[model samples]
Each structure stands twice: as C-alpha cells, then as structure tokens.
Target: MISKLNLENILFLDIETVPETAHYSDLDPTKQALWDAKSRYQRKEEYSAEEFYDRAGIWAEFGKIVCISVGYIKMEGEVRQFRVTSFYGDEVKILNDFKTLLNTHYQEQKYLLCAHNGKEFDFPYIARRMIIHHIELPNKLDLFGKKPWEVPHLDTLELWKFGDYKTYTSLKLLTNVLGIPSPKDDIDGSEVYDVYYKTKEIERIVVYCEKDTIAVAQIFLRLRGDQLLQEHEIIHV
Candidate 1:
C-alpha cells in the first residue's frame, strides 16, 4: 500500500514528444519497403507506421519541451500549500536543467517520481534523449527493464492494473471516472506537433505537459484515498 510508503519525498514528472524526422527517408531497403507499405495505408486514411517515426521526429525537432512542471505538497502550519515549479526552456537546455534538478535538488530526497503511462513511453523517451545529449539520468529513471512492481518506480498506469492485466485505461478516462477536472483546452496530444510548428508557442506545449503532470498527481492522490492536491504540490510555470 502507498500508505505504508513515504509520500513526503515524492516528485511528479511529465514530458511531451513529437515525431522523429532526422533522415527518416534514409532507411535501409527492408525498412524502406516497410515504410512504403505503411505510407500506402496512410494514403488510404489508415494507420501509418511512418507516422510513428514522423511524429517522433517532429517532437525531436520543433518540440521544445518548454516546461517540466513539478508538483509537491509540504506540510505548512494548519494548511497545506501546493507548490508547482515549471522548469522551462529549449529541448537541450530544459533537459539539462531537469537533470541538474534531479541530481542536485531531488538526489538526497527519498522520493518517487510519478507519472501516467511513464513505464511504456515517457520514462524511456526521456532516458534515451538524456543519453543522446550525454546527460546522466537520475537513479529513479534507471530502472528500465525491471518488473513493474520490483522497481522503486511507480506508474499510475501500472497501479491502475490493480492486479488485473486486462484493465487498460488512459489518464483521460481515469480522470473522468474520478471526477478530476481535465486541464486541457488550447491543445491536445494530437495537435501538439502542429501547434508548435504553426505558432512556435512553446507555452501551449508547456501547458499540455503541466496538465499531464497534474493528471498523474491527481491519479496518485485518488489512489491514495480521494485526496486532491493540497496546493503546495501545484506548481505553475
């Protein structure tokens, strides 16, 4: 049970991704054939394997992570004030800043990094990029292939399993079921790449990332016993 676990030292994190476009067309013959087949489906308004690469590259390019919003609640007197700090910047710089914060500020803290669907996507994506940028990853994120429950990592998605492997749920769906108000408005996951390309407004992306982090935190509180964030854990960039 999370109650048996210490909650005071936990940190929440979320990241945004776009398609990978660096020399996408330079695929080997076999991959090129596969790409061509997938492109045919995309032309037919069906799924596109190429879209996956394209999307990843898009995020890799103009997708400035812009903000890494963090939330934590510290006990304050009779009231708890939620503190949310949004670290913002270009992809390279922002990632570097996050690494510094994780190492310097969050290192000594016995806190768990929480996120939604972090196991399948967000965690690995961030780790790979950090490696590419030559930045050291926090110990929390280093648990890549470990069993779901074995590592110190806590994924709300995995928790949602509740010992049921067949019950797959999305953050949006869980929030709705739990009555957690959705913070999304201007942009969504699909529009993220387009918004960055059209307006180059990293704020929108940042806000989206903020909402995701909040959703993860909300899920954590919900699972912990219907307790919403107590203010200090809410950081506004």
Candidate 2:
C-alpha cells in the first residue's frame, strides 16, 4: 500500500520524447549523395526509428525530450494531496531543471521512485541523458547497476500482475478497467515529436505527461485502498 509508503520521500516522473531525424531507409539505401550531403544535425548515425523503439535511449529516433513532468504527493492528514511541477525547455534545460528539483527536494533516504513503465523506459532514458549531460542523479534514481526488480522501483504496470503475462495492457486500458477517467486529450506517443517540433508547444506535452502521472497516482491510490479523487475533488494541491 502507498499509504504505508513514505509519501514525502517519493516522486513520480514521466517524459515525452521525439525522433531525432528521418533519413534512414527501412529498405535499401538508394541515395548515397543524400546521406552525404545532409547536415550533421539531420544525420542519425546511432539508430533509426525501428532501432530507437528497440534500444530505448537518446540515440533512439526520439532524439530529445520535449517535456518532463514530475508529480509530488504527501499525505496531508487523512487526505492525500498532490502537486504537479512540469518542466519544459530545450533537452538540456528540462533535464537540468528536473535534476535541480530532485536535488533540492527528494535527495533523501528511503525515497521510492514511481512511474508507469519506468523500469523499462522513462527511468533509463532520463538517467542516460542525465549522465550524458554530466548531471549527478539523485539517490532514488541511481538505479543503473541494479537488477530490474532489485531496485527500489515501483511500476504500476508491473503491479497489475492480475493480467496474463502474454496480455500486455496500456496504462489507459488499466485506468479504464479501474473506472478511472482517461486524461488522454493531448497528442499521444505517436504525435509527440511532431507536436513538440511543429507547434513548439511544450504545454501540450506537459499536459500529456501530467495525465500519465495523475493516472499513475490514481492507480496507486486504488492499489493502496485510498480514496480516489472524483471530478470535483480535483482542486489543485
């Protein structure tokens, strides 16, 4: 139960990423000239979109992070209140800002880091980028050398062990099963890059990240036997 968890010590985060470039061919390369003439920025030397999907890193076609959303919650008496702090900027800036917040606030003992699919994607991506930028990760996020289940990681997706191992389900699907309202209004994972680049609107990405965090929170509440906030109870923490 999250009620037994040290609420003040835990932090939840989610990230939105986009493809770096679209130059590689899934088929035979017909244009040696096109590949040579393209600017270094446009050239993706490490990985392609397919490879990105598999490898799951900065090299992945999702070149950079457009938004990083952090949700902090505490048991304020009998009620659990939450505050969402979203960071939006260039890749470095967003990562740096997030690191700064973690250093200032969550750098402590016995703090469990929670995220949806974090064990697989979000946590690793952030840690890799942070290391690339020479930023020191907080104690809670220092999960590089540990085994997947060995680390102090809480993934709601993993918690829902109720489903068959072959039947992978989305957070949205789990939310639906739990009777939680879907907050998936903004662009989805597919449109992440286009939305971030075309509109340069991090707010939309922020909302998307926020919805995921809130969904995770709701999922946590359900698992912990806490009262899930209704439509009207969503007053900002």
Candidate 3:
C-alpha cells in the first residue's frame, strides 16, 4: 500500500518541545500540585515530581512546542528534491503558521502527515497544543470523529512495528537498523529542554528537528523499496 501512495502527497514533520516553564517552582501552586499528581505514576518511588519536571515536555498540557519542521518530496522533471522548512519561536505563532500550511496546501483528502512516531507523539501533541491555543485544527489534524480508515496520518514507528506493538522503537534506533543516516549526532531529546530554555539555541534545535523530518521521509521511501535521498537532494528553506 505504501508503494502505491504518492510521495508528494505526504508532509513529513517533527517537533521540538520544552516544559512550559523552566522549573517546577515556576508553576503556580495549583499547577505544581496537579503536575505532581500527573507524574506520580511515571515517577514511581524513585523521583519526585520536581525531579521529573524535565520530562514535562512529553505531555501536551505541561509543555509548549518550540519548533515544527516539515519536509516533502518535490519532483522537478527527473530530479527528486526534499524541501524542508520550520515554524518556530512563539508557541502560538508556530501553531498558527503550521495551520496555515495545512489549510492552504495539504488539505486534500489524499494528503497525509507523517512522522517517526507521529501517531503516538508528534501528531497528537500538535493537535492538543493547537486546541490549547484556540486554533482551529486543519483538516489533516482534525480527527475528532473520523473512522479509523478515514484518518490520514502515518507513523514510521508503527509501520516498522508491522502488527507487533510490544516493543517501542526510537527514531534513532530505527534509522540505525534501517540504514538511514542518524539525526541525533547533535543534541538528543533529553537535551532539547536545556538547549531551548538555557542556551536559547533555537536554530540548533531547528536543524536537529529538520534532520528528523528528513529521516522520517527517508524511512518512508525505504519502506517502499526506494533509494535513500542523497546529501545534495535535501534543501533547507
């Protein structure tokens, strides 16, 4: 089925997020207590909610998106070019710009949004964040009442699973095993919070995020038995 789909019809995406605040103490008393309850199960007895704050970005309510990088295959004659761009800076602006992209360009019934583990992470995170900011969901992200088959999104992680849902695969590990170039040569997910909050190195995270977007595209091609994209074929805009 993957081989039958048009590459240009899919938008490959990745997002970088950080905790809503730099520290647990930055939250109001109500939010702090709520966070404590929210993270209690994940924290178990090993770590307190304060210690677990670094991972708050993983939850939509506790985090804000810092970057959203998207890529798509552009076919010009015999050339296959992968064009990448990002929406970053203010959280609301990021969501608004992304919504514009979806509404203006990829709103067709045939289009899809793809990510490494998008179904589990990127896709829903973006949706929840958009709702939090009072932005209307673009057709592709609006999955409120659609049937399962009516959904138009793809996850490289789920594709690789092939019906085995027991093991979770990271994008880095999947790229390594699939022979695609690793996108984690720089900072990883763990350091995104520090990089965005402490260093304010948004461009650095944008580059990393774009690489992941390209990697997701490459994985989709690989799954369809196509050649991997060459270095010269990927463009940043």
lDDT of 1 by residue, 1-237 (tens): 876765657777777765433334656667657655655644455545554554543223222354567766566665654556666656678788777777876776366777788777666777777777777777766765867665656789988888787777987788899888776656777776666666677777777878878888888888888578744546474
Q: Clash number for every model? A: 23, 3, 0
* Residue 199 of model 1, lDDT score: 66
lDDT of 3 by residue, 59-111 (tens): 99999999999999999999999999999999999999999999999988999
In model 3, the runs with Cα more than 4 Å from the true position are: none
Which segments of model 2 are wrong by more than 4 Å?
1-3, 21-62, 144-150, 162-165, 231-237
In model 3, pairs of residues that clash are none
| TM of each candidate vs. truth | 0.79, 0.76, 0.99
Please give the RMSD to the true structure for each candidate, in Å: 4.2, 6.3, 0.7
Candidate 1 stretches with Cα past 4 Å from truth are 20-54, 57-66, 144-150, 230-237
